[model samples]
Target: MYLVHTAHWQFLGLTLGFLAWILTMVTAGLNEWRLWHMDDVSVITSGVAWVGIWKVCFYTHVLPQMEFCRRISMSDSFLPVEIPVAQVLMALAVICGLAGSISGGVAMRMVYFTVEDRRNIRLVFILTGTLYLFSGSCSLVPLVWNMNSVLINSTIDFPPEYYLPVVPVRQQVGTAIGVGIFASILMFISGLMFLCYKYARHTLRSVAPRSTSNPLRGPWTTTAQRSNGVNKGSDNPAFLSEEVSC
Candidate 1:
């Protein structure tokens, strides 16, 4: 009999995890975390700025937008101690996701282990599941941390007469954050499914019947025999027991 019964669940978990990793990468690469708009200001003077992990983008509020705009890199800053924390963390998360996805793929459905035995297959699933959990954690920390930073720094006080209103024009969460959240959730669920599949597979293997080709070990072919005398014949001398001989 095949050792593992629940291979379908493992495949589902790996697919979901890989998809989540892709979403996270796409979210981290974009630059639309925050936006600012002016309602009662002139189009010539009104403009908007967006925040991202890598750079800040500015655009004019005119109907026909100008071709020129400004972009400031996060690595060029000198006052904030010359370290791009958000970029580094997000890159690390991507790396971890890649590693986890590869490991999980190798462990799923016995695709990578054609020459290995059944007893050691469960270990691969457990290891890959742990890696996936770590990958999810790495992805979650940066987005949430950067979100908090944006909220704290966007607290600028300005009147309505200003061209760039800070009070009414709130800093809303970007599409990247939403996508990252969804990716994190999917990764977490995938890791949990992998772990569950491992446990369930172990349980199934334990209760299954073991196969043996040797007929001597079978219960029906045992060495013991009953002494019923049904095999003895009256004509045989060995069957003539005592005084009443035939």
Candidate 2:
């Protein structure tokens, strides 16, 4: 059999994990995790300035138009605690997701191809699940933290050279954070599915031996002694009626 759960859901889980990894990588590279709006200002420069773990941007699509994105340093004086924390967390998430993906792919191949013993297959599945779960956790912490900060209009003691307002009149979660949230959820679910698959396969395989271990009682056959006894009327002849040809 294809397994008790049929393995379809497990395939979906692996696909979800791969998509989450891609989104996390994109989120790590994006500068839209948080936004600061300058639309209230009465100048052509008025627009949005967004920031990420390692970079910030300032841009206006109209008059005096330009786009500027520059890397920010964790070592900068008086930087918000969130930035440095996000840098480490997002990097860790990317790394973990990558490791999980590689292991997961290899494990899938081994499973469908029957390349190893059952114990080794179980181990690989568990390892992949752990790594993906860790990746989701890493992403969720920083993304949620920054989203809360934006909700509260959190401020920092950024030095004047940084040109960031101590408190922007308007701020919101950005595209990157939204993407991270979705990716985190998908990654989390995928990890859970993989773990379930591992345990279920183990449990089901262990029980299967008990059901058909006796060749005489196998699903597709019966004991020759039983057949002979029935033929000779030593056993219940009525039972053989069921298997008799017309």
Candidate 3:
């Protein structure tokens, strides 16, 4: 008989995480739409929307299957069937999708702020886009691997009474791990870049000099005084006559 080892808590955690990711993606999509309709649309709008679409798809299709697999596995009355690795991979893909969405969203926000530095803006887009792409790829890994597994494992050991379809659990798990790693890496990179940009801009502004006015002079006033050759001491006749009595 198949023994179910359902990690209910872990499943719940993952579910919540996926939901949060979906929320973030939706928020990003709305933000992008708002920007797009505006006269001052940003270049980052498309990028953000791309990230959001991937996230929504992952949550809607992939995450539910993963949850179902996990729940069925933990059920006491269920057969002792192994969970396919494909499902695990799918879960991981969802996580990666989440990370990508977040990274893209943040990058888009940065662009919207009109962060004058072109270099910084480009860097933000490159890093975030890379994360989004990598995670999206990782999300598909389990599905691909599982299909391959099923094709290869045509004749597996199974009792005549055991009637559960063999799903690719291991492949799924591998995919999930891959996605999780990619997501984590991107999160770290984007966060570091954001902090560095903030610090550099702040430091540059802090040490800059302030413009000041001279206490007793304007440009025209100073020029007039110089051309007139008027001396304050000349008002005293005694001081003037001492040097040139003629």
Clashing pairs in 2: none
Tens digits of per-residue lDDT, candidate 3, 37-90, equal: 112113222111111111211111323333111122223233222224433444
Residue 245's lDDT within candidate 1 is 65
Q: Candidate 2: how large is its RMSD?
A: 10.5
Candidate 2 ranges with C-alpha deviation above 4 Å: 1-6, 39-44, 60-63, 198-246
Best by lDDT: 2
Predicted structure with the largest TM-score when compared to the true one: 2
Compared with the true structure, the alpha-carbon lDDT of candidate 3 equals 0.36
* TM-score of every candidate relative to the true structure: 0.64, 0.74, 0.34
TM-score of 1: 0.64
Candidate that beats the other on TM-score, 2 or 3, i.e. the better one: 2
Q: In candidate 2, what are the lDDT values of residues 1-246, reduced to their tens digit?
A: 243344566677789999999999999889998888764443325467777888776753443566666678889766688888999999999999999988888777666665335567778888888999999999999999999999998876656554666777788899999999999999999898878874334333454444636666566443344464475324456777866844
> What's the ranking of the predictions by lDDT, best on top?
2, 1, 3
For residue 39, give model 2's deviation from the true position in Å.
5.4
RMSD of each: 8.8, 10.5, 19.8
Superposed model 1: Cα runs more than 4 Å off: 1-4, 38-46, 61-74, 78-83, 109-116, 152-168, 199-246
